[model samples]
Target: MRAISIPLPGGPEVLTLGEHPDPDPGPGQVLIEVAAAGVNRADVSQRLGHYPSPPGTSPLPGMEVSGTIVALGRGVVGRSIGDRVCALLPSGGYASLVVAEAALLLDVPDSMNLVDAAGLPETLATVWSNVFMLAGLRAGETLLVHGGSSGIGTTAIQLARAHGALVATTAGTDEKLAACERLGAVILINYRTEDFVERLLDATDGRGADVILDAIGGAYLDRNLNALAPRGRLAIIGNQSAARGTVDVRTLMSKWLTIHGSTLRARPSEEKAAIMASVRENVWPFVVAGQVVPVIDQRIPFAEAARAHRRLEASEHIGKLLLIP
Candidate 1:
Protein backbone atom coordinates (compact mmCIF):
# COMPACT_ATOMS: atom_id res chain seq x y z
CA MET A 1 0.00 0.00 0.00
CA ARG A 2 1.11 3.57 -0.69
CA ALA A 3 0.68 5.92 2.27
CA ILE A 4 1.46 9.50 3.18
CA SER A 5 3.82 9.61 6.13
CA ILE A 6 5.19 12.50 8.15
CA PRO A 7 8.76 11.26 8.51
CA LEU A 8 9.55 14.31 10.65
CA PRO A 9 7.20 16.77 12.27
CA GLY A 10 7.75 20.13 10.61
CA GLY A 11 5.77 21.44 7.61
CA PRO A 12 3.94 20.22 4.55
CA GLU A 13 7.33 19.40 3.05
CA VAL A 14 7.76 16.72 5.66
CA LEU A 15 4.97 14.61 4.19
CA THR A 16 6.43 11.78 2.10
CA LEU A 17 4.56 9.29 -0.05
CA GLY A 18 6.07 5.82 0.13
CA GLU A 19 5.25 2.15 0.26
CA HIS A 20 3.87 0.82 3.55
CA PRO A 21 2.34 -2.41 4.72
CA ASP A 22 -1.46 -2.66 4.35
CA PRO A 23 -3.30 -2.46 7.68
CA ASP A 24 -5.40 -5.39 8.76
CA PRO A 25 -8.62 -5.06 10.73
CA GLY A 26 -8.43 -5.84 14.42
CA PRO A 27 -11.34 -7.02 16.54
CA GLY A 28 -14.50 -5.01 15.89
CA GLN A 29 -12.82 -3.21 12.97
CA VAL A 30 -13.05 -3.22 9.18
CA LEU A 31 -10.40 -2.84 6.50
CA ILE A 32 -11.27 -0.32 3.82
CA GLU A 33 -9.66 -0.07 0.40
CA VAL A 34 -9.40 3.71 0.44
CA ALA A 35 -10.79 5.68 -2.50
CA ALA A 36 -10.61 9.19 -1.06
CA ALA A 37 -9.74 10.97 2.15
CA GLY A 38 -10.63 14.25 3.83
CA VAL A 39 -8.04 16.85 4.80
CA ASN A 40 -8.63 18.61 8.12
CA ARG A 41 -7.02 21.19 10.37
CA ALA A 42 -6.13 18.41 12.76
CA ASP A 43 -4.07 16.85 10.00
CA VAL A 44 -2.19 20.13 9.65
CA SER A 45 -1.49 20.22 13.36
CA GLN A 46 -0.23 16.66 13.26
CA ARG A 47 2.07 17.44 10.35
CA LEU A 48 3.47 20.47 12.19
CA GLY A 49 4.19 18.41 15.36
CA HIS A 50 1.46 20.15 17.33
CA TYR A 51 -1.00 17.26 17.58
CA PRO A 52 -0.07 13.60 17.96
CA SER A 53 -2.13 10.60 17.05
CA PRO A 54 -3.44 8.73 20.07
CA PRO A 55 -1.41 5.89 21.54
CA GLY A 56 -1.75 2.62 19.57
CA THR A 57 -3.27 4.40 16.51
CA SER A 58 -1.62 4.85 13.12
CA PRO A 59 0.77 7.78 12.69
CA LEU A 60 -0.53 8.82 9.27
CA PRO A 61 -2.35 12.16 8.99
CA GLY A 62 -5.84 11.67 7.61
CA MET A 63 -8.93 11.66 9.82
CA GLU A 64 -11.75 10.57 7.52
CA VAL A 65 -12.11 8.39 4.46
CA SER A 66 -14.58 6.88 1.98
CA GLY A 67 -13.97 3.47 0.45
CA THR A 68 -15.16 -0.10 0.06
CA ILE A 69 -14.96 -2.67 2.80
CA VAL A 70 -12.69 -5.57 1.88
CA ALA A 71 -12.78 -7.49 5.18
CA LEU A 72 -14.31 -7.40 8.63
CA GLY A 73 -12.48 -8.30 11.83
CA ARG A 74 -13.74 -10.57 14.58
CA GLY A 75 -16.78 -9.41 16.59
CA VAL A 76 -17.96 -7.15 13.76
CA VAL A 77 -21.54 -7.84 12.69
CA GLY A 78 -24.18 -6.27 10.46
CA ARG A 79 -21.51 -5.07 7.96
CA SER A 80 -19.74 -7.04 5.29
CA ILE A 81 -17.23 -6.95 2.48
CA GLY A 82 -18.13 -4.99 -0.67
CA ASP A 83 -20.07 -2.38 1.31
CA ARG A 84 -19.54 1.23 0.28
CA VAL A 85 -18.94 3.26 3.42
CA CYS A 86 -17.43 6.44 4.75
CA ALA A 87 -15.73 6.25 8.12
CA LEU A 88 -14.18 8.49 10.73
CA LEU A 89 -10.65 7.31 11.37
CA PRO A 90 -8.37 8.29 14.20
CA SER A 91 -5.41 8.14 11.82
CA GLY A 92 -4.01 6.40 8.70
CA GLY A 93 -6.59 7.65 6.21
CA TYR A 94 -3.93 8.99 3.81
CA ALA A 95 -3.32 5.67 2.18
CA SER A 96 -4.59 3.18 -0.37
CA LEU A 97 -5.90 1.09 2.51
CA VAL A 98 -6.79 1.74 6.16
CA VAL A 99 -8.59 0.02 9.02
CA ALA A 100 -11.45 1.64 10.91
CA GLU A 101 -13.81 0.64 13.68
CA ALA A 102 -16.87 -0.99 12.17
CA ALA A 103 -19.21 0.98 14.40
CA LEU A 104 -17.81 4.26 13.08
CA LEU A 105 -18.69 3.35 9.50
CA LEU A 106 -21.62 5.11 7.81
CA ASP A 107 -23.39 4.01 4.65
CA VAL A 108 -22.90 6.40 1.76
CA PRO A 109 -26.09 8.13 0.67
CA ASP A 110 -27.47 7.14 -2.72
CA SER A 111 -27.18 10.73 -3.92
CA MET A 112 -23.43 11.06 -3.17
CA ASN A 113 -20.37 9.52 -4.73
CA LEU A 114 -17.55 7.89 -2.75
CA VAL A 115 -15.20 10.85 -3.23
CA ASP A 116 -17.72 13.34 -1.85
CA ALA A 117 -18.60 10.98 0.95
CA ALA A 118 -14.97 11.14 2.08
CA GLY A 119 -15.51 14.72 3.21
CA LEU A 120 -18.61 14.03 5.27
CA PRO A 121 -17.62 11.89 8.27
CA GLU A 122 -15.33 14.10 10.32
CA THR A 123 -17.13 17.41 9.80
CA LEU A 124 -20.57 15.85 10.02
CA ALA A 125 -19.72 14.02 13.24
CA THR A 126 -18.08 17.13 14.68
CA VAL A 127 -21.00 19.45 13.98
CA TRP A 128 -23.70 16.98 14.97
CA SER A 129 -21.92 16.02 18.18
CA ASN A 130 -21.06 19.56 19.24
CA VAL A 131 -23.97 21.67 17.99
CA PHE A 132 -26.96 19.36 18.20
CA MET A 133 -26.15 16.68 20.78
CA LEU A 134 -23.89 18.53 23.20
CA ALA A 135 -25.39 22.01 22.94
CA GLY A 136 -28.95 20.82 22.44
CA LEU A 137 -29.70 23.16 19.54
CA ARG A 138 -33.43 23.37 18.89
CA ALA A 139 -35.77 24.82 16.29
CA GLY A 140 -36.41 28.60 16.30
CA GLU A 141 -33.18 29.22 18.20
CA THR A 142 -30.18 31.18 16.97
CA LEU A 143 -26.92 29.35 16.13
CA LEU A 144 -23.64 31.15 15.48
CA VAL A 145 -20.74 29.47 13.69
CA HIS A 146 -17.22 30.87 13.53
CA GLY A 147 -15.13 30.45 10.37
CA GLY A 148 -18.26 30.19 8.23
CA SER A 149 -16.33 29.33 5.06
CA SER A 150 -14.68 26.31 6.65
CA GLY A 151 -15.83 22.75 6.07
CA ILE A 152 -17.06 22.38 9.65
CA GLY A 153 -18.66 25.80 9.73
CA THR A 154 -20.41 25.37 6.39
CA THR A 155 -21.79 22.03 7.52
CA ALA A 156 -22.95 23.56 10.80
CA ILE A 157 -24.76 26.40 9.06
CA GLN A 158 -26.66 24.09 6.72
CA LEU A 159 -27.54 21.59 9.44
CA ALA A 160 -28.73 24.28 11.84
CA ARG A 161 -30.82 25.86 9.10
CA ALA A 162 -32.25 22.48 8.16
CA HIS A 163 -33.38 22.08 11.75
CA GLY A 164 -35.23 25.45 11.52
CA ALA A 165 -32.69 27.51 13.44
CA LEU A 166 -31.54 30.97 12.41
CA VAL A 167 -27.85 30.91 11.50
CA ALA A 168 -25.13 33.59 11.84
CA THR A 169 -21.55 33.12 10.71
CA THR A 170 -18.29 35.09 10.71
CA ALA A 171 -15.76 35.10 7.90
CA GLY A 172 -12.76 37.23 6.92
CA THR A 173 -13.67 38.20 3.37
CA ASP A 174 -16.65 39.31 1.29
CA GLU A 175 -16.39 36.23 -0.92
CA LYS A 176 -16.35 33.91 2.08
CA LEU A 177 -19.32 35.73 3.62
CA ALA A 178 -21.24 35.40 0.38
CA ALA A 179 -20.60 31.66 0.41
CA CYS A 180 -22.02 31.50 3.90
CA GLU A 181 -25.06 33.53 2.88
CA ARG A 182 -25.77 31.10 0.07
CA LEU A 183 -25.78 28.30 2.64
CA GLY A 184 -28.65 29.93 4.59
CA ALA A 185 -26.70 32.09 6.98
CA VAL A 186 -28.96 35.04 7.78
CA ILE A 187 -26.27 37.19 9.42
CA LEU A 188 -22.76 37.36 7.98
CA ILE A 189 -20.01 39.18 9.86
CA ASN A 190 -16.73 40.10 8.22
CA TYR A 191 -14.37 39.47 11.11
CA ARG A 192 -11.50 41.31 9.49
CA THR A 193 -13.34 44.64 9.27
CA GLU A 194 -16.07 44.47 11.89
CA ASP A 195 -16.71 43.27 15.41
CA PHE A 196 -18.59 39.96 15.28
CA VAL A 197 -19.79 40.30 18.87
CA GLU A 198 -21.66 43.50 18.08
CA ARG A 199 -23.00 42.27 14.75
CA LEU A 200 -24.25 39.01 16.19
CA LEU A 201 -25.94 40.71 19.14
CA ASP A 202 -27.56 43.36 17.00
CA ALA A 203 -28.77 40.79 14.49
CA THR A 204 -30.65 39.01 17.23
CA ASP A 205 -32.04 42.18 18.78
CA GLY A 206 -29.67 41.89 21.77
CA ARG A 207 -30.71 38.30 22.45
CA GLY A 208 -27.36 37.04 21.20
CA ALA A 209 -26.73 33.45 20.04
CA ASP A 210 -28.32 30.50 21.78
CA VAL A 211 -25.65 28.16 20.48
CA ILE A 212 -22.16 29.10 19.26
CA LEU A 213 -19.87 26.64 17.45
CA ASP A 214 -16.31 27.97 17.69
CA ALA A 215 -13.08 26.77 16.10
CA ILE A 216 -10.90 29.66 17.22
CA GLY A 217 -10.52 28.92 20.89
CA GLY A 218 -8.73 31.44 23.15
CA ALA A 219 -8.41 34.33 20.73
CA TYR A 220 -12.20 34.73 20.66
CA LEU A 221 -13.07 33.52 24.16
CA ASP A 222 -13.86 36.90 25.73
CA ARG A 223 -15.87 38.10 22.78
CA ASN A 224 -17.66 34.75 22.54
CA LEU A 225 -18.85 35.08 26.12
CA ASN A 226 -20.15 38.56 25.51
CA ALA A 227 -22.00 37.39 22.41
CA LEU A 228 -23.79 34.50 24.09
CA ALA A 229 -27.43 34.76 25.05
CA PRO A 230 -28.70 33.79 28.49
CA ARG A 231 -28.44 30.05 28.97
CA GLY A 232 -26.37 29.84 25.82
CA ARG A 233 -23.99 26.98 25.01
CA LEU A 234 -20.56 27.55 23.47
CA ALA A 235 -19.22 24.38 21.89
CA ILE A 236 -15.47 24.53 21.28
CA ILE A 237 -14.25 21.90 18.82
CA GLY A 238 -10.86 23.30 17.85
CA ASN A 239 -8.05 25.51 19.07
CA GLN A 240 -6.78 26.94 15.80
CA SER A 241 -5.74 30.06 17.67
CA ALA A 242 -3.79 30.10 20.90
CA ALA A 243 -5.33 27.70 23.42
CA ARG A 244 -4.78 29.65 26.60
CA GLY A 245 -6.99 32.55 27.72
CA THR A 246 -8.57 34.05 30.81
CA VAL A 247 -12.32 33.78 31.27
CA ASP A 248 -14.62 36.37 32.78
CA VAL A 249 -16.07 34.52 35.71
CA ARG A 250 -18.67 37.19 36.42
CA THR A 251 -20.23 37.06 32.98
CA LEU A 252 -20.28 33.27 32.98
CA MET A 253 -21.99 33.16 36.35
CA SER A 254 -24.43 35.96 35.64
CA LYS A 255 -25.50 34.69 32.22
CA TRP A 256 -25.47 31.02 33.23
CA LEU A 257 -23.58 30.08 30.07
CA THR A 258 -21.93 26.73 29.34
CA ILE A 259 -18.56 26.25 27.68
CA HIS A 260 -17.96 22.73 26.38
CA GLY A 261 -14.92 21.41 24.52
CA SER A 262 -14.28 18.03 22.88
CA THR A 263 -11.95 16.26 20.46
CA LEU A 264 -13.38 13.37 18.49
CA ARG A 265 -10.10 11.68 17.62
CA ALA A 266 -9.12 10.90 21.19
CA ARG A 267 -12.51 9.66 22.28
CA PRO A 268 -13.41 6.02 22.97
CA SER A 269 -14.66 3.92 20.07
CA GLU A 270 -18.04 3.31 21.69
CA GLU A 271 -18.69 7.06 21.98
CA LYS A 272 -17.94 7.64 18.29
CA ALA A 273 -20.24 4.75 17.47
CA ALA A 274 -23.05 6.41 19.41
CA ILE A 275 -22.49 9.72 17.64
CA MET A 276 -22.51 7.98 14.25
CA ALA A 277 -25.79 6.31 15.11
CA SER A 278 -27.34 9.65 15.99
CA VAL A 279 -26.02 11.20 12.79
CA ARG A 280 -27.48 8.40 10.70
CA GLU A 281 -30.86 8.72 12.38
CA ASN A 282 -31.11 12.52 12.62
CA VAL A 283 -28.77 13.93 9.98
CA TRP A 284 -28.75 11.42 7.12
CA PRO A 285 -32.34 12.29 6.21
CA PHE A 286 -31.33 15.90 5.64
CA VAL A 287 -28.53 14.79 3.34
CA VAL A 288 -30.90 12.53 1.41
CA ALA A 289 -33.45 15.34 1.06
CA GLY A 290 -30.84 17.77 -0.32
CA GLN A 291 -30.96 20.02 2.74
CA VAL A 292 -27.23 19.37 3.33
CA VAL A 293 -24.42 18.82 0.84
CA PRO A 294 -20.66 18.40 0.79
CA VAL A 295 -18.92 21.67 -0.07
CA ILE A 296 -15.55 20.77 -1.58
CA ASP A 297 -12.93 23.41 -2.32
CA GLN A 298 -10.42 21.25 -4.14
CA ARG A 299 -9.42 17.68 -4.95
CA ILE A 300 -5.78 16.68 -5.04
CA PRO A 301 -4.10 13.42 -5.94
CA PHE A 302 -3.14 11.38 -2.88
CA ALA A 303 0.54 11.50 -3.78
CA GLU A 304 0.41 15.32 -3.70
CA ALA A 305 -0.67 15.47 -0.08
CA ALA A 306 1.76 18.28 0.65
CA ARG A 307 -0.01 20.59 -1.78
CA ALA A 308 -3.30 19.97 -0.04
CA HIS A 309 -1.68 20.81 3.29
CA ARG A 310 -0.23 24.02 1.86
CA ARG A 311 -3.62 25.06 0.50
CA LEU A 312 -5.31 24.49 3.86
CA GLU A 313 -2.51 26.21 5.83
CA ALA A 314 -2.79 29.26 3.58
CA SER A 315 -6.51 29.38 4.35
CA GLU A 316 -7.36 29.70 0.66
CA HIS A 317 -10.09 27.09 0.54
CA ILE A 318 -13.84 27.60 1.08
CA GLY A 319 -14.74 24.09 2.20
CA LYS A 320 -13.42 20.54 2.55
CA LEU A 321 -10.32 19.41 0.60
CA LEU A 322 -10.14 15.83 -0.65
CA LEU A 323 -7.27 13.51 -1.53
CA ILE A 324 -8.09 10.90 -4.20
CA PRO A 325 -6.15 7.67 -4.02
Candidate 2:
Protein backbone atom coordinates (compact mmCIF):
# COMPACT_ATOMS: atom_id res chain seq x y z
CA MET A 1 0.00 0.00 0.00
CA ARG A 2 1.08 3.57 -0.67
CA ALA A 3 1.50 5.72 2.44
CA ILE A 4 2.88 9.12 3.32
CA SER A 5 5.25 8.93 6.27
CA ILE A 6 6.94 11.64 8.31
CA PRO A 7 10.42 10.17 8.75
CA LEU A 8 11.77 12.84 11.11
CA PRO A 9 10.77 15.88 13.08
CA GLY A 10 11.36 19.03 11.00
CA GLY A 11 9.65 20.97 8.23
CA PRO A 12 7.23 19.59 5.66
CA GLU A 13 10.28 18.29 3.82
CA VAL A 14 10.41 15.38 6.26
CA LEU A 15 7.32 13.73 4.76
CA THR A 16 7.76 11.06 2.08
CA LEU A 17 5.43 9.03 -0.17
CA GLY A 18 6.19 5.37 -0.73
CA GLU A 19 5.03 1.80 -0.22
CA HIS A 20 4.38 0.37 3.25
CA PRO A 21 2.86 -2.85 4.50
CA ASP A 22 -0.93 -2.77 4.60
CA PRO A 23 -2.25 -2.68 8.15
CA ASP A 24 -4.64 -5.45 9.08
CA PRO A 25 -7.85 -5.29 11.08
CA GLY A 26 -7.58 -6.09 14.78
CA PRO A 27 -10.32 -7.09 17.18
CA GLY A 28 -13.37 -4.80 16.90
CA GLN A 29 -11.67 -3.01 13.98
CA VAL A 30 -12.36 -2.69 10.26
CA LEU A 31 -9.81 -2.39 7.49
CA ILE A 32 -10.67 0.44 5.12
CA GLU A 33 -9.27 1.14 1.68
CA VAL A 34 -8.72 4.84 2.16
CA ALA A 35 -10.12 7.27 -0.42
CA ALA A 36 -9.75 10.62 1.31
CA ALA A 37 -8.30 12.06 4.52
CA GLY A 38 -8.71 15.27 6.51
CA VAL A 39 -5.78 17.55 7.38
CA ASN A 40 -6.00 19.07 10.84
CA ARG A 41 -3.88 21.35 13.05
CA ALA A 42 -2.85 18.30 15.04
CA ASP A 43 -1.43 16.83 11.84
CA VAL A 44 0.60 19.98 11.30
CA SER A 45 1.96 19.83 14.83
CA GLN A 46 2.78 16.15 14.44
CA ARG A 47 4.62 16.82 11.17
CA LEU A 48 6.72 19.47 12.94
CA GLY A 49 7.47 16.93 15.74
CA HIS A 50 5.68 18.96 18.39
CA TYR A 51 2.88 16.40 18.91
CA PRO A 52 3.88 12.78 18.93
CA SER A 53 1.49 9.88 18.45
CA PRO A 54 0.56 7.85 21.51
CA PRO A 55 2.54 4.67 22.27
CA GLY A 56 1.71 1.76 19.93
CA THR A 57 -0.15 4.10 17.56
CA SER A 58 0.89 4.72 13.96
CA PRO A 59 3.57 7.32 13.28
CA LEU A 60 1.73 8.87 10.36
CA PRO A 61 -0.37 12.02 10.77
CA GLY A 62 -4.06 11.62 9.87
CA MET A 63 -6.96 11.90 12.27
CA GLU A 64 -9.97 11.18 10.04
CA VAL A 65 -10.55 9.10 6.93
CA SER A 66 -13.31 8.17 4.44
CA GLY A 67 -13.13 4.90 2.58
CA THR A 68 -14.70 1.50 1.84
CA ILE A 69 -14.58 -1.33 4.34
CA VAL A 70 -12.79 -4.36 2.94
CA ALA A 71 -12.82 -6.58 6.04
CA LEU A 72 -14.05 -6.67 9.63
CA GLY A 73 -12.09 -7.91 12.62
CA ARG A 74 -13.11 -10.09 15.55
CA GLY A 75 -16.18 -9.17 17.63
CA VAL A 76 -17.29 -6.67 15.03
CA VAL A 77 -21.01 -6.85 14.21
CA GLY A 78 -23.77 -4.53 12.96
CA ARG A 79 -21.36 -3.39 10.21
CA SER A 80 -20.37 -5.47 7.26
CA ILE A 81 -17.88 -5.55 4.43
CA GLY A 82 -18.26 -3.06 1.56
CA ASP A 83 -19.80 -0.37 3.77
CA ARG A 84 -18.94 3.16 2.67
CA VAL A 85 -17.81 4.44 6.05
CA CYS A 86 -15.94 7.45 7.33
CA ALA A 87 -14.33 7.19 10.74
CA LEU A 88 -12.36 9.10 13.37
CA LEU A 89 -8.92 7.56 13.62
CA PRO A 90 -6.41 8.08 16.39
CA SER A 91 -3.59 7.88 13.85
CA GLY A 92 -2.58 6.53 10.39
CA GLY A 93 -5.01 8.12 7.94
CA TYR A 94 -2.55 9.26 5.26
CA ALA A 95 -2.38 5.97 3.43
CA SER A 96 -4.14 3.85 0.82
CA LEU A 97 -5.43 1.66 3.71
CA VAL A 98 -6.05 2.10 7.43
CA VAL A 99 -7.97 0.36 10.22
CA ALA A 100 -10.67 1.90 12.38
CA GLU A 101 -12.78 0.71 15.29
CA ALA A 102 -16.16 -0.46 14.00
CA ALA A 103 -18.00 1.59 16.60
CA LEU A 104 -16.21 4.75 15.43
CA LEU A 105 -17.38 4.27 11.83
CA LEU A 106 -20.08 6.60 10.50
CA ASP A 107 -22.06 5.85 7.38
CA VAL A 108 -21.62 8.62 4.85
CA PRO A 109 -24.98 10.16 4.01
CA ASP A 110 -26.27 9.55 0.53
CA SER A 111 -25.83 13.24 -0.18
CA MET A 112 -22.12 13.29 0.73
CA ASN A 113 -19.09 12.02 -1.12
CA LEU A 114 -15.93 10.44 0.27
CA VAL A 115 -13.92 13.67 0.29
CA ASP A 116 -16.49 15.64 2.31
CA ALA A 117 -17.03 12.72 4.63
CA ALA A 118 -13.33 12.69 5.34
CA GLY A 119 -13.56 16.28 6.56
CA LEU A 120 -16.56 15.64 8.82
CA PRO A 121 -15.51 13.06 11.43
CA GLU A 122 -12.75 14.81 13.39
CA THR A 123 -14.25 18.32 13.59
CA LEU A 124 -17.82 17.11 14.04
CA ALA A 125 -16.83 14.66 16.75
CA THR A 126 -14.81 17.29 18.61
CA VAL A 127 -17.51 19.97 18.44
CA TRP A 128 -20.32 17.59 19.32
CA SER A 129 -18.47 16.25 22.33
CA ASN A 130 -17.09 19.53 23.66
CA VAL A 131 -19.83 22.07 22.88
CA PHE A 132 -22.92 19.93 23.41
CA MET A 133 -21.89 16.94 25.51
CA LEU A 134 -19.36 18.41 27.90
CA ALA A 135 -20.33 22.10 27.94
CA GLY A 136 -24.09 21.38 27.79
CA LEU A 137 -24.83 24.23 25.34
CA ARG A 138 -28.49 25.03 25.86
CA ALA A 139 -30.99 26.51 23.45
CA GLY A 140 -32.03 30.18 23.49
CA GLU A 141 -28.54 31.06 24.75
CA THR A 142 -25.50 32.80 23.34
CA LEU A 143 -22.32 31.01 22.17
CA LEU A 144 -18.96 32.37 21.09
CA VAL A 145 -16.44 30.48 18.97
CA HIS A 146 -12.80 31.51 18.68
CA GLY A 147 -11.02 31.08 15.34
CA GLY A 148 -14.32 31.30 13.45
CA SER A 149 -12.70 30.66 10.05
CA SER A 150 -11.36 27.31 11.21
CA GLY A 151 -12.97 24.00 10.32
CA ILE A 152 -14.06 23.32 13.89
CA GLY A 153 -15.24 26.87 14.51
CA THR A 154 -17.28 27.04 11.28
CA THR A 155 -19.02 23.75 12.10
CA ALA A 156 -19.61 24.84 15.70
CA ILE A 157 -21.27 28.08 14.55
CA GLN A 158 -23.73 26.31 12.24
CA LEU A 159 -24.60 23.60 14.76
CA ALA A 160 -25.18 26.08 17.59
CA ARG A 161 -27.36 28.21 15.29
CA ALA A 162 -29.37 25.16 14.22
CA HIS A 163 -30.06 24.44 17.88
CA GLY A 164 -31.47 27.95 18.45
CA ALA A 165 -28.42 29.64 19.97
CA LEU A 166 -27.22 33.10 18.92
CA VAL A 167 -23.65 32.68 17.70
CA ALA A 168 -20.65 35.04 17.85
CA THR A 169 -17.29 34.34 16.27
CA THR A 170 -13.77 35.80 16.57
CA ALA A 171 -11.27 35.83 13.75
CA GLY A 172 -8.30 37.91 12.58
CA THR A 173 -9.70 39.69 9.53
CA ASP A 174 -12.81 41.12 7.92
CA GLU A 175 -12.75 38.47 5.20
CA LYS A 176 -12.65 35.69 7.79
CA LEU A 177 -15.48 37.39 9.66
CA ALA A 178 -17.52 37.43 6.45
CA ALA A 179 -16.91 33.72 6.03
CA CYS A 180 -18.06 33.13 9.60
CA GLU A 181 -21.22 35.18 8.98
CA ARG A 182 -22.08 33.20 5.86
CA LEU A 183 -22.04 30.08 8.01
CA GLY A 184 -24.72 31.38 10.44
CA ALA A 185 -22.69 33.41 12.88
CA VAL A 186 -24.89 36.19 14.19
CA ILE A 187 -21.97 38.40 15.33
CA LEU A 188 -18.37 38.63 14.11
CA ILE A 189 -15.37 40.27 15.78
CA ASN A 190 -12.00 40.87 14.25
CA TYR A 191 -9.76 39.82 17.13
CA ARG A 192 -6.61 41.09 15.49
CA THR A 193 -7.77 44.73 15.53
CA GLU A 194 -10.65 45.05 18.02
CA ASP A 195 -11.30 43.76 21.50
CA PHE A 196 -13.49 40.64 21.39
CA VAL A 197 -14.52 41.21 25.00
CA GLU A 198 -16.26 44.46 24.09
CA ARG A 199 -17.86 42.92 20.99
CA LEU A 200 -19.21 39.96 22.90
CA LEU A 201 -20.72 42.22 25.52
CA ASP A 202 -22.14 44.47 22.83
CA ALA A 203 -23.68 41.59 20.91
CA THR A 204 -25.30 40.07 23.98
CA ASP A 205 -26.32 43.34 25.60
CA GLY A 206 -23.74 43.07 28.40
CA ARG A 207 -24.79 39.52 29.29
CA GLY A 208 -21.80 37.89 27.56
CA ALA A 209 -21.83 34.53 25.76
CA ASP A 210 -23.22 31.51 27.62
CA VAL A 211 -20.49 29.22 26.31
CA ILE A 212 -17.23 29.57 24.42
CA LEU A 213 -15.23 27.19 22.19
CA ASP A 214 -11.67 28.42 22.47
CA ALA A 215 -8.49 27.25 20.70
CA ILE A 216 -6.24 30.23 21.33
CA GLY A 217 -5.13 30.07 24.94
CA GLY A 218 -2.35 32.55 25.81
CA ALA A 219 -3.40 36.10 25.00
CA TYR A 220 -7.10 35.31 24.83
CA LEU A 221 -7.27 33.92 28.38
CA ASP A 222 -8.31 37.00 30.33
CA ARG A 223 -10.37 38.33 27.41
CA ASN A 224 -12.27 35.04 27.13
CA LEU A 225 -13.18 35.24 30.81
CA ASN A 226 -14.29 38.80 30.32
CA ALA A 227 -16.54 37.74 27.43
CA LEU A 228 -18.34 35.08 29.47
CA ALA A 229 -21.60 35.60 31.27
CA PRO A 230 -22.13 34.41 34.82
CA ARG A 231 -22.09 30.60 35.00
CA GLY A 232 -20.62 30.38 31.50
CA ARG A 233 -18.64 27.34 30.40
CA LEU A 234 -15.38 27.58 28.44
CA ALA A 235 -14.31 24.37 26.73
CA ILE A 236 -10.66 24.54 25.71
CA ILE A 237 -9.91 22.12 22.87
CA GLY A 238 -6.50 23.34 21.73
CA ASN A 239 -3.53 25.27 23.15
CA GLN A 240 -2.24 26.79 19.95
CA SER A 241 -0.85 29.90 21.63
CA ALA A 242 0.43 29.22 25.15
CA ALA A 243 0.34 25.86 26.85
CA ARG A 244 1.24 27.53 30.13
CA GLY A 245 -0.88 30.65 30.28
CA THR A 246 -1.65 32.02 33.73
CA VAL A 247 -5.22 32.67 34.84
CA ASP A 248 -6.68 35.03 37.41
CA VAL A 249 -8.34 32.92 40.07
CA ARG A 250 -10.29 35.89 41.39
CA THR A 251 -12.07 36.39 38.07
CA LEU A 252 -13.00 32.73 37.88
CA MET A 253 -14.39 32.70 41.38
CA SER A 254 -16.44 35.91 41.11
CA LYS A 255 -18.04 34.88 37.80
CA TRP A 256 -18.76 31.26 38.87
CA LEU A 257 -17.42 30.14 35.50
CA THR A 258 -16.33 26.66 34.45
CA ILE A 259 -13.13 26.27 32.43
CA HIS A 260 -12.45 22.88 30.89
CA GLY A 261 -9.45 21.73 28.81
CA SER A 262 -8.97 18.52 26.84
CA THR A 263 -7.21 16.80 23.93
CA LEU A 264 -9.07 14.10 22.00
CA ARG A 265 -6.07 11.97 21.08
CA ALA A 266 -4.96 11.48 24.69
CA ARG A 267 -8.31 10.01 25.70
CA PRO A 268 -8.98 6.32 26.21
CA SER A 269 -10.37 4.30 23.31
CA GLU A 270 -13.68 3.60 25.01
CA GLU A 271 -14.24 7.32 25.62
CA LYS A 272 -13.48 8.17 22.00
CA ALA A 273 -15.89 5.45 20.91
CA ALA A 274 -18.59 7.00 23.05
CA ILE A 275 -17.95 10.43 21.51
CA MET A 276 -18.24 8.90 18.05
CA ALA A 277 -21.49 7.21 19.01
CA SER A 278 -22.97 10.48 20.26
CA VAL A 279 -21.96 12.24 17.03
CA ARG A 280 -23.59 9.54 14.93
CA GLU A 281 -26.82 9.69 16.93
CA ASN A 282 -27.15 13.46 17.23
CA VAL A 283 -25.06 15.08 14.49
CA TRP A 284 -25.21 12.73 11.50
CA PRO A 285 -28.78 13.67 10.60
CA PHE A 286 -27.79 17.34 10.41
CA VAL A 287 -25.29 16.47 7.72
CA VAL A 288 -27.82 14.37 5.80
CA ALA A 289 -30.39 17.17 6.00
CA GLY A 290 -28.01 19.90 4.80
CA GLN A 291 -28.21 21.93 8.01
CA VAL A 292 -24.41 21.37 8.26
CA VAL A 293 -21.82 21.04 5.54
CA PRO A 294 -18.06 20.45 5.27
CA VAL A 295 -16.42 23.80 4.48
CA ILE A 296 -13.46 22.71 2.38
CA ASP A 297 -10.71 25.25 1.68
CA GLN A 298 -8.40 23.09 -0.46
CA ARG A 299 -8.23 19.60 -1.99
CA ILE A 300 -4.88 18.28 -3.14
CA PRO A 301 -3.72 14.82 -4.13
CA PHE A 302 -2.65 12.60 -1.21
CA ALA A 303 1.00 12.34 -2.21
CA GLU A 304 1.33 16.09 -1.70
CA ALA A 305 0.82 15.66 2.02
CA ALA A 306 3.87 17.82 2.67
CA ARG A 307 2.26 20.77 0.89
CA ALA A 308 -0.92 20.31 2.88
CA HIS A 309 1.03 20.49 6.12
CA ARG A 310 2.79 23.64 4.97
CA ARG A 311 -0.49 25.31 4.08
CA LEU A 312 -1.95 24.62 7.51
CA GLU A 313 1.18 25.79 9.37
CA ALA A 314 1.05 29.07 7.44
CA SER A 315 -2.64 29.49 8.41
CA GLU A 316 -3.45 30.67 4.88
CA HIS A 317 -6.73 28.81 4.36
CA ILE A 318 -10.14 28.72 5.98
CA GLY A 319 -12.18 25.60 6.84
CA LYS A 320 -10.83 22.11 6.17
CA LEU A 321 -7.94 21.03 3.93
CA LEU A 322 -8.47 17.56 2.42
CA LEU A 323 -6.26 15.02 0.65
CA ILE A 324 -7.69 12.52 -1.85
CA PRO A 325 -5.67 9.33 -1.58
List the lowest-lDDT window of 10 residues for candidate 2. 239-248
lDDT of 2 by residue, 169-285 (tens): 988888889999999998889887888899789878899988999998766777788889999999999888855666788889999999988889878999999999888889888
| TM-score versus the correct structure, for each prediction | 0.98, 0.97
Whole-model lDDT, candidate 1? 0.93
Off by over 4 Å in 2: none
- lDDT, candidate 1, residue 207? 91
